[model samples]
Target chain A: AQSVTQLDSHVSVSEGTPVLLRCNYSSSYSPSLFWYVQHPNKGLQLLLKYTSAATLVKGINGFEAEFKKSETSFHLTKPSAHMSDAAEYFCVVSESGKLVFGAGTILRVKS
Target chain B: EPEVTQTPSHQVTQMGQEVILRCVPISNHLYFYWYRQILGQKVEFLVSFYNNEISEKSEIFDDQFSVERPDGSNFTLKIRSTKLEDSAMYFCASSFGQETQYFGPGTRLLVL
Candidate 1:
């Protein structure tokens, strides 16, 4: 079984500042993790995924996340936050073809 | 780029009435999934399908819910008798093999 936990339900960051969203996972087997963003009234868009291949994954819009097995964390980061980045982000875990998603983290970019 | 598409962006149905939601997955995708999100709640997985059969289903997918791929491109979810609690935004997603899943905009079901 695979489960993902998001550290925060809401994260507020100022424009031009850095952004971080924390996530952790518990899985019996090696897991595939992903981050997705959903804008208001829109479907989810994949941010990035960490398969067995790479620990550090880069996604679109200058966003990236690093998977740390020792810490059991996959935290999303962006060097400079933009107002358009405000959305609901989800951390997901998958093992053996089953995908489970965390509740979600709502990001607010304060100008 | 190709993406998943769903029909009837919004539907209003009375309690005990039946409803069918439709979706057209990506062209090259080989798997299909259905999910639902009640207002102010997290998205919940309902069922997954592959090889023209159900691969897995969550507890939320009860006997009242059924899925069918009647033709080459369309996948449908049928709710036998909707209740007021059935009001939600239903999403249809697709993927290839075990890869990333792409989702549709979702169909908002309002059962009165």
Candidate 2:
């Protein structure tokens, strides 16, 4: 079974500071990883995906994630946090055509 | 860019009533999916559709739930009897294959 665990249920950061949302996965074989963001009352938006290509994957809204095979981690990062970055983030792993999602990390950007 | 779309941004219904949630996938996409998230819960996959039939479904998808692509563009999920537990945000998504899926603004269903 492919599954993902989001380390933090909530993360708070000051504006213009770097942000990190941790995630770890367990998979039997090579896995596909993704990060998605959901603003309040909005849909889940794909931030980035890793499919055995480059380990470092860049996504929209100045977000990126690195797939670390040894660590079994794909952590999302942003150089600077903006107020609009406050949202719920989900770390997902794809397996057998379905997505196994993490509990989610709620990001809070403080001004 | 072409994106998936869903109807009835919000719906309130009485328990035991039937409800149909609709979706229009990207024009050229071949695979479609439905997922739901209860309040403060992880998003869960319900079912996946391809070639006018269900290709995969999760354990959460029961006989009470059915999916149809009645027309060339529209895909729908029907719940035969709505329950209070059914209240959640339902999302519709589509993909060119199975790699990446684009989601639509979900429909918030409130069962009273």
Candidate 3:
């Protein structure tokens, strides 16, 4: 069985400042990880994904995440936060081709 | 940029009434799915479909819930009877095999 844990339920970041949302996973096999963003009342948008290919994955809207195997973490990051970046973030893992999502992290960007 | 599309962006229903949510996945996509989010909760997988049959389903997809690809370009989820707890945002998603899944905006069902 595979599961994901988002370290924080909420995070606040100042506009133009750096943003970091932490996530860790537990899986029996080498897992596939993904990040999704959902704006208010909208569906989830795939941010990025880490297959067995790249350790550092780059996503849309200038976001990226590093797949750290030893630490069991796949934290999302962005160098500069924008008001449009304010939304809920979800860390997900895939096992047996099934996607299981974590309790999302709400990100608030303030100017 | 083709994506999954869902119907009835918002639906209000009474307890014990049946509600059906609809979806149209991207053309050529072979896999379809339904997921739900109770306000402030993690997205829960309800069911996955392929080849005109259910590929996988979670515990939450009880007897009250059923999925059908009754026609081309249409996939539907039918709730046999509604409960107050059933009020939530239901999302329809599709994917090409094991790759990333594209999601629909969701139908906000409010059971009153």
Top candidate, metric TM-score: 2
In candidate 3, stretches whose alpha carbon ends up further than 4 angstroms from where it belongs are none
TM-score of chain B of 2: 0.99
Give the better candidate number (1 or 2) by TM-score.
2
Comparing candidate 2 with candidate 3, which one achieves the higher DockQ? 2
Each model's fraction of native contacts: 0.49, 0.71, 0.74
Predictions in order: lDDT: 0.92, 0.95, 0.93
Pick by DockQ: 1 or 3, better one:
3
RMSD of 2: 0.7
Deviation in Å, model 2, residue A85 alpha carbon = 0.8
lDDT-best of 1 and 3: 3
Q: Worst lDDT window (10 residues) for model 3 chain B?
A: B94-103
Query: Sorted on lDDT, highest at the top, how do the candidates line up?
Result: 2, 3, 1
Give the TM-score comparing model 1 with the true structure, all chains together: 0.97
Which segments of candidate 1 are over 4 A away from where they belong? none
lDDT tens digits, residues A12-99, model 2? 9999999999999999999999999999988889999999999999999999999999999999999999999999999999998788
Q: Evaluated on chain B only, what is the TM-score of candidate 3? A: 0.98
* Selected candidate, larger TM-score, 2 vs 3: 2
Which candidate has the highest DockQ of all? 2
How much RMSD separates candidate 3 from the native structure? 0.8
